[model samples]
Target: MSSSLPLSGRVGIITGGARGIGYAIAKRLLQDGASVCLWDVDETALSEAKASLSSLGNVATAQVNVTDAASVEAAVQTTLAALGKIDLLVNNAGIAGNNAKLWELTPEEWRRVLDINLNGPFLCCRGVVPQMLKNGFGRIVNIASVAGKEGNPNASHYSASKAGVIGLTKSLGKELATSNILVNCITPAVIETDILKQMTQQHVDYMLSKIPMNRFGQKEEAAAMVAWLCSEDCSFTTGAVFDLSGGRATY
Candidate 1:
């Protein structure tokens, strides 16, 4: 790898890295000269992702259930074993649970989304931060959503979960401010990804209508922003939310 590449010699862990936005981020990071460890619950997809991405750079995969602390910890160890050290973490594993009004949703449904979308990142950070601190450098870029800010109707669970992610990023960022471990998050309006499949057509259309650009964002666009946030170029910013909302974000 060329020393001039921004992420050269870095090792990163990307949860939900088997596909969609996560896969795009992994590919971008690899192309930027970082080795990557893909963590996902789907073993088959993990294998496929590793096979496809191995040509770009050093790539490894671990079947992980982000919601489980044991699973997250084991994957952290696995990544350390495979890649030596972790310089970046992208908390991207999440789901758009079945759309329903807040009152109509079952407690189980609400908890499931929170467990994966919020608590998962918490565990991964807890597991990975020690290594980053030991190395005295790290970056954490969480994948939040515009819904978290606006709170889309019928997706109360997802919106709340992502909101928690934003809160987590801010608190963690402040906690690591002087440690050289920058933490931040991105709030994307609507990216074209498999997660969309879990939403109703009405909901998708409603989200699309809210964007001033009138077009869905591509996964690569999200990947590009995340790549920068994971690099040394993002040195001065931490605990901030970068908007990828195509002009939909009012704040």
Candidate 2:
């Protein structure tokens, strides 16, 4: 059966696209026929990601630290210069800073996590939204976490950052509601990715035990939701939170 691709002719920028869930989302978007620009902090990983994903379709690579406005702005310009215009944005770049109790966590650690996980998306949006507004169309997907909803005990930093992301999604969605731009977020519980290495074994076990499915989510599963949210098919839904927690989320 012949099927038409919904994202054909679209161009997208995926932050943290070098690996993990971000990598999977890039691959999925490519399969759906969108030209993808992979943005990451690691130049080596970005090169490897671009190489691996090139066979799927048009691909570009950029080194960006999303938390830095200058870095993000430069990347946006580069992406526009290369891809013409950005039609979609996937804010997936984030860090699972050292796991520790709220009291045990240092102020520096908290700021670092917020800078990358929360400030990163804000900066990326600030850089890209102007172009999207000019084009009159865009899709933004911020990858959040179930911890944002539940507030994990030892992961205050991660949880708080994601919660901010959720709040950002809602507010931005409303601001762009009348426009052709759609802003939404996904909250997944414990996806099995290299980011897991950042967490302690005890922390990992705690997260897994909370998942009703008794297992961590797959990167592909999260990627699928992102692909859909970025497509025209996702029209009418903006500033919404799509749950990918595998029965872990109550609401």
Candidate 3:
């Protein structure tokens, strides 16, 4: 590991890391000289990701259910044991959920979205922060969405869940402000990913029309931003929401 590498000697854990933006983030972190543990609920995907990423650097995989505290704790232990110490946490696991009117959504539908998008990050932070505290350094980047800021019609559950993530990032950032554990989030309008399959075409076109750039963001683009956020250079910003909305976010 060259000292010139921004993340040399750092270790990171990326939730939902088997595919999409999470997978891209794992690759970027590895390229930047950080060892990473990829966490996801799909065992097959985890194995495949590790196989593909191992040549880039030291990579580990954990089958995790972020909504469950016990599962998150086990993955934390797995990461620490594999990589020694945790320096960065990217809460990238999430779902767009089913696009529908708020009144049409069932209690289970709403809870499912909230559990994975919001509670997952909370559980991950709860489990990983102690190790970071011991190391006296940490970086937490939650993957929020522009929908959280400007609510999307027929996607109330998704919007509200991401809004909760923004709130979590702010609250946690402040609590650990003095502890050298900087926390922040990214609110992307839309990035090209398989997650789009879960959404309706009408919803997708509506989101695309809002982006002044007239195109969807690529997964690698999101990964590049996250790489910087996880690096030592991102020292001054915490509790902030960085927009990757292609001019869709006004504030």
- Identify the candidate with maximal lDDT: 1
| Candidate 2 accuracy as TM-score | 0.98
Least accurate 10 contiguous residues by lDDT in model 3:
1-10
TM-score between model 1 and native: 0.99
Q: At residue 134, what lDDT does model 1 achieve?
A: 99
RMSD of 3: 0.6
lDDT of 3: 0.95
List, residue by residue over 1-251, the lDDT tens digit for candidate 1. 89999999999999999999999999999999999999999999999999999999999999999989899889999999999999999999999999999999999999999999999999999999999999999999999999999999999999999999999999999999999999999999999988889989999999999999999999999999999999999999999999999999999
Candidate lDDT scores, in order, read 0.96, 0.95, 0.95
Tell me each candidate's RMSD, in Å, in order: 0.5, 1.4, 0.6
Q: Candidate 2 on 77-187: residue-level lDDT in tens?
A: 999989999999999999999988999999999999999999999999999999999999999999999999999999999999999999999999999999899999999
Regions more than 4 Å wrong, model 2 = 1-3
Clashes of each: 0, 0, 0
